[model samples]
Target: MKVQSSRDFKLQREVDYGTPEQNKAVKQIVADIKQEGDAALFRYTEKFDGAQVDSSNIRVTEEELKAAYNHVEDSFVAAIRAAADNIRAFHARQKRNSWMDLQPDGTILGQIIRPLQRVGVYVPGGKASYPSSVLMNVIPAQIAGVPEIVMVTPPATGGKEGIDPYILVAAAEAGVNEIYRVGGAQAVAALAFGTESIAPVDKICGPGNIYVALAKREVYGAVDIDSIAGPSEIVVLADDTAEPAYVAADLLSQAEHDEMASAILVTPSQRLADAVAAEVERQLRELPREAIARASVDNYGAIIVVESLEEGISVVNRLAPEHLEIVAQDPMALTGAVQNAGAIFLGPYSSEPVGDYFAGPNHIIPTNGTARFSSPVDVDDFIKKSSLIYYSKEALLRDGSTIIELARREGLEAHARAVEIRLENEAKGGVERGE
Candidate 1:
């Protein structure tokens, strides 16, 4: 890790999110999938993953799902079930019902809340098995009453023929049965445009490599996506009271995620900064993903010595990290100052991983400074809203003149006439009936 003063540190780091060649390749892949459907999917699976896929092996069978349980240990099952319970309970609170406001003037104004018919969740399956991602993606859609939650993962894990059993078990536990063995931009394309084997989904949600992120960006209008995520990031705001070892370890946790991952420590205390910098280097040697973590820390990570804790908060807001840990003496007091971050972890105990796996909050957080506008995946992502308006004779007549005036002012004669005709009919009927 490198140390620098706040004035010298550059908060933003340049990254090649995707090269032009990669973007062009993904565009071609998406286009091929759109045009050829199942044929394109098979070709890409064989080309990128060296796996075979056809009508017979496109979807995971019930027998394979059953065998998944046999492969995992009993402890893994118990842990996932417990985590599922917590996730369900948390998301259930976010579930909403259709509501209408009936006015005394015989008018109704409301919104109709309905879940999407189907959704596709893409879980990356190349580096490691992320059963936690299964829980994070599926539970919210399930809570929102999405009828069919289809999932797509890579055809192989660790260069093997089949998907990881732990991933299968997690999907089963999360109540997702429609599993397809596909991945990368090709899977995203398959989800956006329906194939003979897989139906189109209303929305797609999850994180993947740059290819997957770019694919989601390309297919946004065809299908809603969570967000075009970037590399993982963590910005820790610490003070003299903060623990050096704990801060170093938490920073490394995210650094190991990828070479582009960032981990920064912003503090006012020079003593704490020196201690954490030393601890990070000492701990980096022991990590199994040392090469990746070291690259990340060297290129993106930093320790900034600020003049005051308030200035440190400003730096944190500027970075807009995916995960933020406030390790100050009064962490909660600075909560309002944190305007941008995907998730906030207060105190030494609330490490980043607590939210990543076990915490009820969705781990699929916005990255690349998008936290300024976007949000994590939630039940609302799986549902759509329709405005419901009912106008009775009395209400329409009361507001008819205003509607006509506004419509005509906009040079919309048809719109104005639509209201005028109804009012004319009501007037003529009243006159004829002598009411």
Candidate 2:
């Protein structure tokens, strides 16, 4: 582990799975699933996940949930339920209502905000099953008044009849009515196009591997997608006052996510940089995922010694990390300067995982520099806005010529003629005497 400058190290490992060739294959899978429905989904599930999922055991049932609940430890279930309650409480405040404004001139215009009718959430079931992610995804849609919140995850190693107790308990706590035992690109396709057993959805949310992301991209038009999510990443901006051990631990947090995941440190003090580098080496030896973390830090991780705190913050903005931690003299002071970042952690106590698990905010954040112009998954992403317009006779007459003129200029004669015909109809009916 060594401390260097930003220009000295640049590790950019983009997803090699979603190439044009792979995209073509994903498109074919989506088309096949769309055409074959359950048969294709079942075949792909077995082929990809090695799970023998069938129409008989497609969705989770109440009986299974009750049994799984009993299987999980009471205290852990209570904690997950508490987290779900907090998540629901925060998202409930984001619920919106359809509104209309009536003007003196009788031009009624407003917006109708409503939730999507159906939504599918993908919960990755690899090394860890994130029931927290279930809470994050489902609570918002439920708050927004969505009728059906369907979920899909790879079958747990437990059995065909049982899933991970944590995931099952969390789904129950999060108010998810439907759960499917399927994963990988096949699960995404099944949700997007619908199978004989699994119903299609209007929008899909949550995180997954590269194959899952590519499947989401493939079925985008058939169903709306949240975003093309990428690997985990973090950028920590620290000063001399920042603790080295804390900085090292925070950097390694994202690093352990995957080999390609990035953990970077930008500081103004060279001494602080060296200390943090040493701390990373010291801690890396003991972390459970030490080899993965070490490889990530060695390749993608960096420690840039900047000229000043301002320079360090500049590098942070340029990186636009999925997670940004500010460990400085006054962490809040640098928040305004933080033009980029999916979620900004202020002060030493606010570690990256705080936002990931327990935080009320949604954890499905924008990644791979998309934070510069994007935002974390929120109540807004699961919603749709409609423009409500009501034109009174007076309002229409006043605004008709402008519309007619614009239509005529655009060579839309039929549009202009439609307005003209309406005016004439009003005149013929003696509604407008000034005609």
Query: For model 2, what is the alpha-carbon lDDT of residue 46?
Result: 84
Clashing pairs in model 2? none
Best candidate according to TM-score: 1
Mind giving the per-residue lDDT tens digits that candidate 1 earns over 47-116?
A: 9999889989989998999998888899999999988998898889999999999999999999999999
lDDT of 2 by residue, 1-435 (tens): 667876675656664557788788788888889899999988988887777788999888888777788778999887887777777777778777889999999889999998899999998877556788888888888888889999998886355544787888888888776999888888899999888999899999988887888999888888999998877899999888888999999999998887778998998889889998899999999989888888888888888888888988888888888999999889888899889999989999999988888768788888888898999877887889999999888887788888999999999999999888777777787455575
lDDT of 1: 0.91
lDDT score of residue 323 within candidate 2: 92
Model 1 clash pairs are: none
Error of 1 at 32 (Å): 1.3
